[model samples]
Target: MRPRFVLPAAFSVAAILLLVSCNRGDLPGKKQLESEQVQASPVAPVVSSKVVEELPEAAVSPLTVEQRLEDFDYMWKIIEENYPFLEVNKRLYGEDWLANKEEYRNKVAAVKTDDEFFRRMRFVLSGLNNGHTNFLSKEEYPWFLESYIRAGLGSEPWVNVFQQSNVLVRYNQKPLTEQQQSPKESNNNVNSGETGSKTGMTSGNVKKVIIEPDQIAYLGTRSFAGNLMEMDSSEIRDFLIEVKDYKTLILDIRGNGGGNSSYWRNNMVPLLINKPITYNTYSLYRGGDYSEAFMQARRLSEGLLPIANIKDEQMPNIPPEATTMFRNYNKNVDIVTPYQSVGFKGEIYLLVDSSVYSSAEGFAAFAKGTGFAMVVGGKTGGDGLGTDPLVAALPNSGYVFRFSLQMGLNSDGSCNEEVKTVPDVEVDPDTSKPLLDQPAIKKVLELAASQ
Candidate 1:
């Protein structure tokens, strides 16, 4: 059965009105407050009589700090000039944050070795308090991550959560590339070994337990990190071909935070089909016509599809077949059907958690709402809205700040900017074990067996 969607006039109008309210804000009042501030400050009166001359622009470069005081001063200036979240920095650092920076710089200067400098930098970066932001200099990071930081997080690696510390926790089907590390022992602990060819082989590196019975296949992809498509396409192809026999499939994207969705269509989905199927799409309107008459007319003229305009990219221009596809103005789309759906005729389940964010959570929300799959897990991390973020590096300091410009909506045109997607079947991690476990695998087995 195809999924159903209906956009009501009242809801659309309300959303538009909300958008209008958000855009037109306290700017006029803020300007008035600024004028009052100028009147109150004694410097404001002196500025009128004094002729201020513009100084020549200074040449900018990375700081060379011989002393800890200089280093701390440099770091504070950089953060104050460029930290991504200004409000957050203010709240955390408070009134005399500069004094703290100077104090830290003094501490750094006291350090006797290069190791101490790195340790100090780590501590300084930690003060930012964002998971996405960190201070791993090019010397410390792998080539891929180094390249990514040079380009920024907008193009970071994707990873699926698999085995953590030698216990199986969940199932992931997304293909991954095994990174090769030098024998000196890499700092990051990623698996680089072969396991048995057993279909339900549990990972010795994982911390949690994930089990798959006979009916369904469970591949715990810890993340969509690195170049899965380019780096390890052959390994993924072989794995998918081997597991193509299963009817019921559970794509454990609970840990997938999304890299490039194109990899799924290319290396993975092609192996599962002998015939083609149409995935629905949605036409998102950024402006105009939230009225019932307009909505009805548009709906009647152009039937609703499952496409989502979360990303700002070109989608397929034509209806996609197995091999060739078209681009849409909408950046991302939820799958109602795979392009080729000849094989694998059974239920699909999506396992999610608070860690499931951005494009990953977007897909889960779509699948759950449209019945594409039975979503099982905890709330997603992101507010499900697409972020159109632009990163800017501070001129004097090499720090970068990213700000979101665009927001996206769900099928009903509801703004998911602040609210995350809640799972249909919420599964909490079992607290009994030192490591948490996902129950979706057990549930999928039971459902498949019953069927």
Candidate 2:
């Protein structure tokens, strides 16, 4: 069963089974009565709707007083009992549920339609001011991902990677190739808009680059929340199989807000080595209430395995569909220590900035603390540790309670539980353009050249 319980944006929930024997002594048809009673309970309505180009104009609903109260009661009950983050809700709303509830009732009454209701709900969710506390429904998740992670076609020729003071800027368009023309000749061609064998290069931001036709690669990872999980390194083995061309790899994690580290550890790590490397043992905390629904689902899943009566058969495993819901369900599981110690000898330069937080900071800290890579850039965003707690809704209002139950720790056993990971190469930026501008790029290039 796709777990009906949700973790919202910033939190992560549980289990139980109850069996009660109904007193059917007086009933003539006991089985039939029991069946009827079982069917009486209601299933929550599914919220699924395609995005409209624009929200419909507000229209007054003809709901009666009783109907409005019923809807209000329904929303309130859902919030109070079902919201995963309890601490957040409790802090925002008070112990006196009735007074706060009445306020929501008035707000709900003022709403003319369902659209207004959800809009208010969104506002209430945003009140937590926590980045992870999103109130998006199932459909909204995919829509948000599609909007954020964009894919482009064709080779961007003029890839200018530079920094504007501190922010990084990646310009599209090939800086005239060696065989093509000199700097002056290319400048003239730009004035005339005439270059031989023109490639349809469009203006775009730089994602990654290999600079100076030499042994240095500069990568600009803006956020860790990209589709790194879906990528398999074997698919791109030919690309990084031999770093013979580039002796030094400058991985610009500058503004990369961390995402799923599993993707980085599993897929990206292998590319660094031509041979296999195993991760050493690391300890992580596990709470007893680490999602019972997930555990139950996992049990049911094993029984339906393809290979019957063969426990040892090495069958290709498929990841659970509900993995995302359990993404933040538990505390630390293991610290990835190299088993064989075949480290990536190529000098690595990690670029970072203030925007890097949570998982991004964790990765940077882990890399530096574990002697993986040297960190560069400005002071980090200072959000290192992450707590994926359950959110419980207020009894009457849209307020949600969020709190952390488990903590993530670095490899050295020092939990970045409260502090941010400071960078090794701390270069202050010019405070003019936004951080994601040319300044970051220039710094990375200059840093690589110096090394």
Candidate 3:
């Protein structure tokens, strides 16, 4: 049971979906209901006979009302069933999503063009207020779809519509079919094509500096996306060798929006720590079409999430699925760290800010909870807990959308997204400077030196 929060008066979409729900009609019986309920086609969704060679052509000629209806219904159904944050959003933001289904469906009905349709869909999803649950931006759509292909969703029939993409390929400056590079291996900037992880956002590149000549050193990177360590293997290797015996190290992640967790887990963590650091946490999944298909497509097993058996009282206000996953977690989803040949015997401090999010936030969570590091700086951007996002395609346009499948919970049962990691020692960052050069980072260094 969820706590009753006073809802804000701005809700437009509700939970009762008239378009998605089946109509029982004047006579209510099993035979009549079976005939009236829409069934998924064995071959393909009902689409036009004409092939859309260029996506822009399809854009110019907006999909018919009925076709758009199918797409809208597809997205809504997926959200209704699999999205874990609906209740969470209502509790935190006072937007009751379940109370406005008819309004959302009407907005979909009023869409005249695909661009407008996309923006409107964005409008609808934004109501959820989750950094992970919202729809992708126009620039982010194609790259996300290409990513799904690697996850084995390419076999989907609607995915073929993306193969012929023209204008959609603008972000990476490469055709979707040709851009099969892995997130860690490929250059997606920050897993997108435009602004780079280490290159974009005016955030300083991945670099190591010896502030007090090896006694105190600092290393900062913008994203865990892309192969940062591998890209600078020799330099990083030499830096680690020089600094492993250092007294104190400051690991700064201020502007990192996130990418792959493995970038830090396997690449970053072990090189500094002497022994494994086990971080116990929960991973939540709302079993449904997208979750089921994603599970199968990725060739994963449900048993992967160890049963938690956590008490409802332990977890405060959060999504039920999050608690359910926690209580049923088979094993702790710990960030089991490995011992390194070159380890830092000195005290390590992690520097973070609101910009540090997603996988970056996960790192903050792990460090704060496991005593892996003395976490300092500002509060994180949150939404860091969870598995990779789940993918879905609008039937008419094959426009792919994604949201989180798993909810991340801290060891104490607080939702990672809601109860973001708070710095043990709060130091205000001088916003005018880069991450390493920030006065707050300097203050932390001073504190470490004093100790």
- Highest TM-score model number: 3
User: Higher TM-score: candidate 2 or 3?
Assistant: 3
Selected candidate, larger TM-score, 1 vs 2: 2
Pick out the ten consecutive residues of candidate 3 with the lowest summed lDDT: 15-24
TM-scores vs. true structure, each candidate: 0.45, 0.46, 0.72
* lDDT winner between candidates 2 and 3: 3
lDDT of each: 0.38, 0.37, 0.57
Best by lDDT: 3
Ranked candidates, highest TM-score first? 3, 2, 1
Candidate 2 structure quality by residue, lDDT tens digits, 84-124? 33332334333334346666667656766444554444444
TM-score for candidate 2, residues paired by index:
0.46
Write the candidate numbers in order of decreasing lDDT.
3, 1, 2
Residue 354 C-alpha lDDT in model 3: 77
Model 1 TM-score (2 dp): 0.45
Prediction 3 global C-alpha lDDT:
0.57
Residues 1-451, candidate 3: write the lDDT tens digits: 1111111111111100011000011112323212323121111111121111123422234578787778778888888777777767777789888688889878778877665666566666667666555444444444344433433332243244344443344212334444444433443333333333243333234778888886888887766653343454345545777888888878887766666555566556667665544455665666665566555443333465433444543656445655452323322444353534465677778888877777788788878887778888888877676556665657666566666665667877777777788988788844577645777777877787687
What does the lDDT come to for candidate 1?
Answer: 0.38
